[model samples]
Target: MQWKTDGPRSIPQAFPYQGSKRALVGQILSLFPTEQVPLLVEPFAGSAAISVAARMYGRAQDIQISDVNAPLMDLWRMIIDSPDDLLDSYTKMWHEQQQGENSLVEAKAYFMLKRREFNDTKDPAILLYLLARCVKAAVRYGKNGDFNQSADNRRMGARPANMQERIHGASRLMQGAKVTSGSYEDPLVNAPREAIVYMDPPYQGTTDVPDHRYLTGLRRDVFSETLQRAVDNQVSFIVSYDVVREDNKYGEPLADDLGLLHRNVVVGVSSQATLVGRKEMSIESLYISPALVQRLGGQDKIDDLIDVEPKTQDALF
Candidate 1:
């Protein structure tokens, strides 16, 4: 699949997910094999910033994206397979809200209608609108597994023209990719030895709360075992899991028994803390499989790529 060069130079992001790795694309991609690989796989696939970046830079000849959330994965499917249809549906809904006498009231009402429709039908367009307009673009779910986030009345979702460009751009880059909605384990277990599987499962802090951040919460033990299986299979992988903000660590670090190389990547200050009148640096944990670490040289080489001094999980914790 040959994509045209008319797309934006920057990585094209099609979703407004809160924990997206859009900011860390450069650092993450730098850690990938310098030579293009046969495939790049993302199991969590939220926003798929890494996949998008990989495609943009020709880091992989093929890409595979999977997520537990069926509707969310369906949106990615639409974006990759039929971007124009997705764009048209989203644009129509985006413009229809303004047709009413009072735009705000109408927008709220339109949001409610779409939310109901989304819950009932799992339409990708409605989910896209809800995510774009929802508060902080954070996905929240009711106990019954319904889309429960409210609309941000101050503004409409992404402008149609911009959305179209992004949709088309992402579609072009992610062309010929295999996308699926199911267990993250599927992609991990099935990934070829030469493929690099990137896992960004829901952070332990976010998923363990009463208000679930993801549609499903991944158990730590299950995840550990999954990584173990991947390691036993000699699959190269990287994980963006856990973080520490201003000396306050969120979630437990992965078990040390996995023998994965651990490094802390400074991801800049915390916007959430800054909003509440505090300045805090946000540092994220990057866990690399031994095979990947060996392939990328060694601990020192990986450290230099991310521009962070050598540090272990114990120091960060």
Candidate 2:
């Protein structure tokens, strides 16, 4: 299925992501009932995929995208504000890395090296484009905030065609969005009461690499306090988290304690051939405040608002 948007036609349908909700943006938007465009805040806005989709589908007006990772936040700002300069720098770096003129280990390594270097520099847009090229699509990092993933030699496809055009198109679409670097809880302290907050944090699970610090030790307590604060302030919120089996020690209890309406949507976790070796599935559990649900009119209308279009298996994997 073709996921259409009211943005640039040159933008590629496939983005660099392992568990991207690019297909589920429409569905997530449907959960909201207010016609007024509330400020949409994505605290852990990885790749800003959901925020981009929310804007594209006309779900929200202004978006506040934030992440704890400085490099990732720089990338979002660049993608939205300075597409031309970013694309030019990315093209030069990519060409140099491709010709073996750079000491970069591979395409993925080259992508991370550029991001690391860009983080310390003043130019943030260039860092974003370089990240899109590197990072194994998932953008994993070690505890020291180091990009330490091996290149996926098998899926090293050519640089996306019309890169500049797509960047410009997306930038135009995201004109009003703001990107920032900080802890998720710090920025939302004074958010508008009517605003909608979407939280997609690191899953509650063990990591293969002992130091693969995706969330910096965000446990159930932190998530609980965040939700309680939003609830007290009458802020409508939606949280997406993985579903662990009943036997597992950690699972739906997190959502249960939040005291909000909950719903589960199944999503494919494997888009790469290498990932197919592990039969993994991702479940998105959306939690909303009870008052917001009633105020939005009803649950049925909210359900109809969100939609998901499954992509062709061949196209994604």
TM-score for each model: 0.91, 0.77
Candidate 1 minimal-lDDT segment of 10 residues:
1-10
Off by over 4 Å in 2: 1-15, 100-130, 133-135, 155-160, 206-215, 244-252, 255-257, 267-282, 298-317
Candidate 2 displacement at residue 297 in angstroms = 2.8
Tell me the whole-model lDDT of each prediction, alpha carbons only.
0.82, 0.61
- Clashes per candidate (backbone, < 3 Å): 0, 5
**lDDT at 10 for candidate 2?**
27
Best by lDDT: 1
Q: Give the C-alpha lDDT of model 2.
A: 0.61
Q: Model 1 residue 272 lDDT?
A: 73
Tens-digit per-residue lDDT, 166-254, candidate 1 = 88888899999888898888689777888999988888777666668888888899999999998988889999888765455577889
Tens-place lDDT digits, model 2, residues 181-201: 888885555577777777777
